[model samples]
Target: MFRATETFATHAVANQPEPADPPDPWADDPALRGRLAAQGGDAQTPAALGAAIRDGDAWALGEAARRHPPELRLWDRAGRRLDEVAFHPAWHALMAMGLEAGYAARPWDGRPGGHVAHAAMVYLLTQAEPGVCCPMTMTYAAVPALRADPALAALWVPRLTAAAYDPALAPVAEKRAATMGMAMTEKQGGSDVRANTTRAERDGEDWRLTGHKWFCSAPMSDGFLTLAQAPGGLTCFVVPRWLPDGTRNAIRLQRLKDKCGNRANASAEIEYERAWAQRLGEEGQGVRTILGMVHHTRLDTAMAPAGLMRAALREALWWCEGRRAFGRRLIDQPLMRRVLADLCLDWEGALALGLRVAAAFDRGEQAFARIGVALAKFLANKRCMTVMAEAMEALGGMGYVEDTPMPMLYREAPLNGIWEGSGNVIVLDVLRTLSRVPEAREALEAEWDAGAGDPPYDAALAAFRDRWPGPPDEGDARLWAAQAAALLTASVLARTAPAPVAEGYARARLADCPPVPGALTGLAEGAILARLGGAGPAGESE
Candidate 1:
């Protein structure tokens, strides 16, 4: 030993290879191509874009994985009030790819499955990167609200639909494309936009705004849709970074929020004094004007958690299959298999229902889509946290490290439930809409009709209605929303998935107490893993 200078335990348990990024995110999706075509999308272009999003070249995913988050520059080198946000090159590259891929413009394209196609594209892209999706979602959501004023719509919609991503803090007129942000929260109240104290004054047909926003998201966007109190009451305005004359407006930057997740994008707090603005719609109707935009954004919020679950589950299963433990592969262990199977069941059901609502947007089911989005957001977003924790457990200690994407995914899992509307806020929203919008109940009824073929699902729906009674109220909104989402998802699976796969989902998921041993015997792990890579359960591809 002294002669050879041998080393001991030099290669203790060599670390296994982490799962690689899919060659094509679009193609790996078990559901995207058919979902798009079923909704009438010409899937050729989006399918092609999938390979780019998979980011085999490493440029896009590399940028997103960089150490630094976006930074804020309050002043320029010459001591001017630049109020700019400086981003790493990775953020810019990822954003540019998404804009060019048409993630923000599909709904406005007016093609068959326009909304469905858009939804599918965003679902695929966000799995690799979530923060960049914020600005894109805002740009997409702002369309309907801006259209409330025909002149404003004519001015902004074309630019928003443009395929270029210009990050420069310059005049909108000078850019080939634009993005949008929203500022609705303040110190006094969070979701209560009615409590806003920002003041607006009339200056000819234009207006001036002066107040503070506790949370002004996507601060670098070219324009913002904000709310302020006017002579008429809470009013909506389009506040731009520059005046028509090309001078920087008075909307000042306070500080960027130090958030736990979503570090790739900048969220800020800011104040303004006489920021020149254009009124969006009738005064005193701010809530009414922005309601349409909220619906769309909620749909985006719901899509995000479902996408995250699919990606995380794939990684968990891949690790289980590759790693040996207790004299056998980890996936061969019964307990590990049970946890992963449960995850797959939830992921498929959530994806199926979420896409159906997205299709409803395409079909103009405004009444059904509105309430459906809330139900899904409340339930699916909550499930994301549970699933992330379970997946991390399946990987043991290594999954908790930042080297893998699991830590980032876990940090982001709870955010969707808190965004747009917190869990309780969503429950109340379900109640508020049930009392106001007749179609809220109709959405549930639609699911019942779709799933009558399965006895268990039909029985579950009956029990759900009995528990919820007529319209749900503040007291039982959580119960109502939970059962409604389960019923809807079960119905979806029963109608479209194979009988064994669908029934397994319902038996394990809808039970009063989840059975101790649940296995989806007919649903193969390879088929579920392929969903994360690009094929459906039926093995079709783009």
Candidate 2:
């Protein structure tokens, strides 16, 4: 109970959602409700996935961890057997799901859906698979605007989309917990889009690309999304892996990075000269298209740390409940209980926050989506690492042992923080959003207001201004920046609203109260609880 007490301490202090209507526990949280609604009609996908994950029908999630565990033990043991397996079942299901639920079903339905379909595919694979290679193929899909170009879409989107599920074109490299794709990282520029010296010049009726890609995951991919510089600017093109003669393209493998994880996926650094390629979008638009894919890809990368953390926490709880210490179950010990409680509360906060970002995408709020995704990914990844370490500590030596799953989870969580974008990069993104986007900042403020019971805007504005006295000549940007900072600061304050009382209890072991640490942490410092008489287990416990 000491551990649970300590854990609950954090949760109690952070804050909780306000009192809500009887039917909807999430009613006070528009963000949560909106997100739950956005991921199709059901927010049960994760739960459902958990239920049937082991089944062949469940897609690659279960197999994903199986594909790459703490060590490459399984792959090294049965690499050939796994590779022979068909295209990742997850990709198939995801593409189908995107077409059904994730499709951008708005004004620009077709193009957006294609983008989404591609995004969903990339997201699942990066989150699920292990390897040092790229997460998505940088598939022609990565060049969506190019793929969907009026001229290119007519020729490419259909062909590439169809080829996506083509088993012949899609090959799985056993299980290495790395990003898998066709092209490899160049020795000179891995992610530096501008530094790519690959050249794709127009040749009669054909565009020929010549350059070296150093970190190709599946160099054997039917085609590679290659970046090259043209006279106008850098451009992206899709180059076939093989020619009509059924021989590999003029692609020469340099070497594969001896990476730490995702070893099962083959990553080859390769050089291609006079490679037959097709330009997707107009020259110089490569960066835009690639960056667009990146915007969506970040969502996928974000899922990885969260998923890893989820798995680790589940393991910790299971161990705590069953493991015995000093004649009592670990969970029965007050200190152990505190740890578990705090872990769970933090987990819930991270989950809700990440889902909120996902909801932004579902809501067609791209700008919000970008900021939310960055924030969620950054925070979740950071938390997961900390959680994994704490979970390990809670278990003592057993946690560090390879026999336990915690170590692997511990290793994986940090990787997601670095992937897609680093933590620092993400924080900068948050700062940039605060600096540039007034509308988003304002909308965020409205969110804070609704949760805490709105303060008079005029009064609040005056109060806000008074708190920050500074020079006038710094202009509107500076003033608004201050306002944005204040608004964000206020949002944090509003996280905990109406406090839970004995009379308001609703359920056993759970109250209609906030369970996440962030939900009540702030209030825990000084709030008083009233033990008003009430009915039910919720009140009875208090």
Best model number under lDDT:
1
Q: Write the per-residue lDDT of candidate 2 for residues 152-189, one digit (tens) a residue.
A: 44543444433223335321122111111435246676
For each candidate in the order shown, give its overall lDDT on alpha carbons. 0.79, 0.48
lDDT for 65 (candidate 1): 43
Worst 10 residues of 2 by lDDT: 501-510
TM-score of 2: 0.63
For residue 316, model 2's alpha carbon misses the true position, in angstroms, by 0.6
- What lDDT tens digits, residue by residue, belong to model 1 across residues 1-542? 12433346664333364445455767776565654554465575567567777654322463364467878888988899988788887788788887887887878887767676677766776677888888999998899999999988887888898877878767777777899999889999889999999999999989999999999889999999999999999999999988878899998998999989888888999887899999999999998998878888888888888878977887898888889888888998999998898887777766767777888898888878888888878778877888889998888998998877788889889888888898888888888888899776876687667887677776777787676668755555666677778777788777666666689878877775222112123445556667688465465443
